[model samples]
Target: MNNGVNVTALAVFVLFFLLVTVMGFMASRWRKADNALHLDEWGLGGRSFGTWVTWFLLGGDLYTAYTFVAVPAAVYATGAAGFFAVPYTIIAYPLVFLFLPRLWSVSRVHGYVTPADFVRGRYGSKALSLVVALTGILATMPYIALQLVGIQAVLDVLGVGGGAGSNWFVKDLPLFIAFGVLAAYTYSSGLRAPALIAFVKDALIYIVIIVAVIYIPMRLGGYGHIFDTAAQKFSTPKSPGSLILAENKQWTYATLALGSALALFMYPHSVTGVLASKSRNTVRRNMAIMPAYSLMLGLLALLGFMAIAAGVGSGVKGFNAQLSVPQLFENMFPDWFTGVAFAAIGIGALVPAAIMSIAAANLFTRNVYKEFIRPDATAADETRVAKLASLLVKVGALAFVLTMDKQAAINLQLLGGLWILQTFVSIVGGLFTRWFHHWALFAGWAAGMVYGTYQAYGIASPATKHFGGSAANIPVIGEIGYIGLTAFVLNLAVAVVLTLVLRALKAPVGTDETDPDDYGAEAGDPKTQNAPVPAAAH
Candidate 1:
């Protein structure tokens, strides 16, 4: 690494940063609406994005800075096991293809701004909707924090941030500045900011990854030498890694992949992307093409092996494995190109962080604030509250980054997936049927949240004592697996059993306001275009 600042690279990084910052502020005018003050316009970009726009928006939202920094970081640290992300993403697109269009149709017909809105309308239980909304907001905090962590990794390698031992203010000032810029643009332009910026973010990422996979290998002799070096590193007798999955970890690998696939679209931000599309066909078309990102993710994961070959973290005392890919770029690429790579990671952070805060804000405004605090809130009021809430959400995420471990961005996200997955039975199950008693679904969600949190808390890694990992021993089966999937199973069981008991006792099951036709509604249909904005139950 360079002994001091990489001036050429830092200049290039700053230039791209300024360009995106300009674009972010200008996005409020990109697709100008009649009245931009309504929640539908500000929070969902007027729910009018077409296939290509939605494609890039979803691409930017789903394939985040975490994908760029953390996935390879995990591969750099744990060898082949890190590649679980690749398969899980592939699995996720196919799974979402089945349900997302249904969600879009229903959301369009009712003007539902959030998944929690659908839960509110579907189950007619304020309590159930409240839990779903709170879970989404809670789970999103750490996920947003992971994005900031990704940006921090880039800044650290660029020699912009002070060392780990510096005063906290000195160390974190750069992150705070980035956070401020993101919050300002998001608050000002709302979803339009990220939607517009995603085009630039996705293009830079594709360019950087494509170049890295090809250019870095030729500089490292070839893929043959790269794989050999990675294998030899993992083969060191004390190392707990391997060039391939170990037989003992196969269950963990498979479970994590399957569990993650199930939970991916369950995230409020993911659903927000789908709901923002102009039509159900746009959503379906995007899903079919979304797997292209999975292919990029596969190539991106190879950077881990390339980092190993490049000796990125070798012999550095107490090195953060998260820095492997960034350091590798600095070591191998020219300073100017290194700046571009850093910008890709930096802007990658902005796009999703903006969307996540907006999603969390929408949940809070529609479910918590409107339903409980102010049922009389108008469309303009909802948008204003959501905008403010978005700022607060980013503040909370910044706190997470300031306080929590930044050892690996992937672990932070998995920790969130564990909590967010608990809502799947409520949201996804509600989509297909209302067979679940609202109260029973509540019971199931509560049970899953308690169990998932407890299991994750007891998992200890070398880095910390609690919530250190996402895997643990599967109950009864006694095999190790993902805690999230295990909790999801228990959630399903509780909901199913309680539903039967509730039915036998003749307990009240809340009304579902939607009709069968609502699920088939499209953008220009009278039912969809004329649908009234959902109001909170009095």
Candidate 2:
């Protein structure tokens, strides 16, 4: 990487950053709502986005800056293992297609603002609801912090921020500026801020990826030479990775992919994107079309191999693997276009960070505060509290970035997936049938959370002593697999056994507030007419 600042790249990055900042603030007026003070308006974009809007929103929300930076970074660090993300994203849509529309339908019918709202209403259990809400907030903090890490990687490449040895304020000023802008717009405009800015973020990402995949290889003597170079590097005896999956690694790869696919929508932000759609069909349509992002992801992952071909970080001391892709762009692209790629990474961080904060805040306001503290809070009051909670959520995420080890932040994010997946039985299972007892599901979630955390905490990596990785050896199977998936198996087994015993003993299952018809309701139906008005209608 250049020791001096790339002034042209920094200028271009600032130009695009300022543009998105303006758009984020202006979004508050884009779909002006009649009662903007209501949680329905502030939290879910008035639950009125159509197919295209919902598509972009969900796309931007899921394919974040971290994915842009980390996927390639993983590839740069571990060869084909990084490609696991591509398959997992492909697997997620089909799996989600089967159930997400039902969630949207029920959420629309009942005006549920968060997944915890659905959980509380479904099982009528405050304890179960609280755990789900807390898990979401916990999982989301590290995820949001990782987005800041993505921005920092780009800033480091551009030489915008001072070096790591500098005073903390000088080192992190750019990131704090970006964070402040994101938090301010999100607080002022709520979900609309991210929804509006997502269009720009996605467009820039696609453009940069398309250009990089084409241009970078040509400059490197084509894909043939790029692959040959990458193969040669990994072929070295002491190299830690390979160009293809080793036989022993197959189980880990498959289980991680499957576990990730199942866990993707269990996240509160993913559910928030689905709930914000205009109708059940909007949710279904977006699911069908969302895989276009996977194609981009596949192309983006090649940048890792491309970085290897370009010899990025070849002999740099204590080089961070996360900076490999950013450095590659700076080395190959002209300074001005390098700024654009950096901006894509920077703005990519903003869209998801905004949505994540909003999603976590909505969880806290609805599930924790309103459900427990003040059951009689009005819509306006909920909106007010959610806005403040959004700011606090951003502050907590900033703490994760500023104070914690970056690797630890990443490990927590991995744990976030494991943590969030534990909720699948309760949220998804409750959608189809009330067969599982609420207390039994809660017990199952607790079992999965404890076992997953314990196993993850015990696994050690070269970088850390505890909480090192997500995969571990299965108990009876005696094969290596994702700890999350194994814990999930244990979770389901417990839920099933306890459910059978509880049913036989005539345990009092909580009342289900939903009817079969609620799962099929759509926008403008008489059943949903009393729901929040579409923002566009105002």
- How many steric overlaps are in each model, in order? 0, 0
| lDDT per model vs. reference | 0.91, 0.91
Best by TM-score: 2
Per residue, candidate 1 scores C-alpha lDDT tens digits across 1-538 of: 5546789999999999999999999999999877777888889998999999999999999999878987888898899999999999989988988889999999999889999999999999999999999999988988898899889888888898776577999988989889999999999999999999999999999999999999999999999999999999999998868888999899999999999999999899999999999999999999999999999999999999999999997888778888888899999999999999999999999999999999999999999999999998888888889999999999988987888667444456677898899999999998899899999999999999999989988888888777789899999999999999999999999999999999999998788999988888888899987887533322
Looking at candidate 1, the ten consecutive residues that score lowest on lDDT are 529-538
Let me know the TM-score candidate 1 reaches against the reference structure: 0.97
Q: 1-538 in candidate 2: lDDT tens per residue?
A: 7877999999999999999999999999989988898878888998879898898899889999999988998898889888999999999999999999899888888888899999998999999999999999989999999999999889888897676678999988998999899989998999999999999999999999999999999999999999999999889998889998898889999999999999999988999999989888988899999999999999999999999999999998778889998999999999999999999999999999999999999999999899889998878888899999999999998988999889999899999999999999999998898889988998999999999999999999988999998999989988899999999999999999999999999999777788899988878688888765433321
Clashing pairs in 2: none
Model 2 lDDT on a 0 to 1 scale: 0.91
